[model samples]
Target: MLEKIFKWILTIVGFALGYAATEIAKNWGFINSIIGTSNIYRIGFISIAIILFGIIFYIVSPFIIKLIFKLTGFLESGIQKIPTNDIILSVLGLIIGLLIANLLITPFARFLAGNTILSIVGSTLTLVVNIVFATLGVNITLKKKDDLYNVFTFLRRFSKDKKSKADSKLGISQPKILDTSVIIDGRILDILKTGFLEGPIMIPSFVLEELRHIADSSDNLKRARGRRGLDILNLMQKELMLPIEVVERDFENIQEVDSKLLKLCQIYNGKIITNDFNLNKVAEVQGVPVLNINELANAVKPIVIPGEEMNIHIIKDGKEAGQGVAYLDDGTMIVVEGGRRHVGEVVDVVVTSVLQTAAGRMIFAKLKSAS
Candidate 1:
């Protein structure tokens, strides 16, 4: 019913335009004078032209609209790699700009009236101007709506990256997806405290649900950790003012949380933030980028070399006999040979070897000779 109404409106508009065009042609003596056209012939000709053009444009309009839809779909699909919130804000800006243009611009243009052709063309141009301003305003707003947190993040990475080369100075920043383990472990709190982590920290709604489940768990330890995670999240949002947005994004038909995480990371070209060793390894296998807290901590740890003597207190016994375990300031584990007797005491040990793994660094050492 609505379509038929639109068609009738179009038909009426077409007839008016066709009658107007014929009148103009006659007044201008373009065609009727050349053929000695009668009044009857002129009326018939004008009516036939009006009916044909209206029918053609109306018939082809649906196809035109479908083509436009396809083009918009292609553009949207391509930009899906960008954050959804940013896209929404951009559209909002576009609407606001169009509204302002309609109210302010069109009327002002109409106030500057002109002659027949000039007036018609000026009105047409005014409509075009409104559309152009709307589009421009939206695009400008979107391009400039830089999230402060995300910007700082890129700056830190960009500074580190500058050490490599002059040409590889910096580029576009990638999205940072916060994983459940990282949130629960609460190391991200400290990282954010330092104001180094850059880019918007996205907490997937599913991840938050998982955190809530952990908080409500039967196990006391898990419950405590879950609550702590929640506290840290609030602190980050309220105190630190970090943009911790929870997106209601999910991978339909996928049940496994890990699988969904990897899929989301791939979809957004985002890096996963997690302390899970297995997830890190799996991400590597799948070629998805990951920002492992363990890896970052390890990178910033003091370098321990073989044959270097260090003073460390033995905290506990290793699984093997006569072996004690110690930790560096950064929490990298060191296995000390023949140091079980030194438990609860500080001892100098000669570093024997260093093992670097996805989890962290491990140091092996033997007790130094007693002076």
Candidate 2:
């Protein structure tokens, strides 16, 4: 029913345009002479023109509708790819630019008075200027939004008579910025809930974008991990008491997420909370503080000394013959020499030595009797 109404509206618009064309044609000297200034003939000519245009529009309306639908879908998809804050800033900039353009054109419009061709030219120029300025404004605003935000925030701080409640809510110190890997690991949420982490937790816009891309990835494992990370983030926001802030500031020139995160930490004078080894190393080299979850886990694991005895269920064979492997409750690997034949059975092993490496801690042991 809606489609039928749309087609009728198109037909009516076509008829109106056809009538306007006939009026313009009647103003021509040759056409006026041909029509002979008769009201009956003029009405007949206009009716014929309307009917012809109405039929043509009716036939093409479906194609036009399909094209419009396709264009709408394309625009919707394209808009979805841009962050919400960016779109808002771009629109604001465009509006401001058009307003400025109008102010500039209004004074000059009077100069073209009584000259139809010049007036038309002036109007066209105004429209072109508005479009050009608006486009330039959008590009400039998007590129400089972070700088503008900082300037406005700084000025507002000085202008205020007293600190607002909102300002007081934020900690005096910088926030801990979370990267994609830490969020995906899902331990950060638990850590935040425990009240061990201080200040508001900051999630950069680019990190969220990276998670979104991962969630939409083709690989099943990656998609699941990404979706789990998103779920963990939502849980942290809704269920945890900690303040979580999604920062809009982003380094557009930086292509790597880790690189952007390090830059963000530098900009905000904040620490990065992540489990990615490479990122942790980079942050250290850059003199940025990083709270590595892996390091924390390793720190909290139970300490073992030589000659310590513990019972473990041998789960698999190690690289060497007769060597069985097991894991501690905290996931520390234990290599039991000469226990491969006892795989799938519980055995008491005496710790011989403990090795700590960048990856994790490992313990070597042998049967209690062998020790």
Q: Model 2, 1-371: lDDT tens per residue?
A: 87788889989988998898898888899877877879988888899988988899899999887788799999999987786668888998999888888888877777875699989988888889899889988998999998875665456445432433444475355579999999999988888878888877899999999999999999999999999999999999899887889999876556899988977786676789999989989888766789999999989889999988999999999999899999988799999999899999999999999999987999999999786
Model 2 — which ten-residue stretch has the worst lDDT?
159-168
- Considering summed lDDT, which 10 consecutive residues are worst modelled in model 1? 160-169
Instruction: Give candidate 2 misplaced runs (Cα > 4 Å).
Output: 1-171
- The deviation in Å at residue 127 for candidate 1 is 38
TM-score of each: 0.52, 0.55
Model 1, position 256, has a per-residue lDDT of: 79
Candidate 2's TM-score reads 0.55
What overall lDDT, based on C-alpha atoms, would model 1 receive against the true structure?
Answer: 0.79
Q: Count clashing residue pairs in model 2.
A: 0
Cα lDDT of model 2 overall?
Answer: 0.87
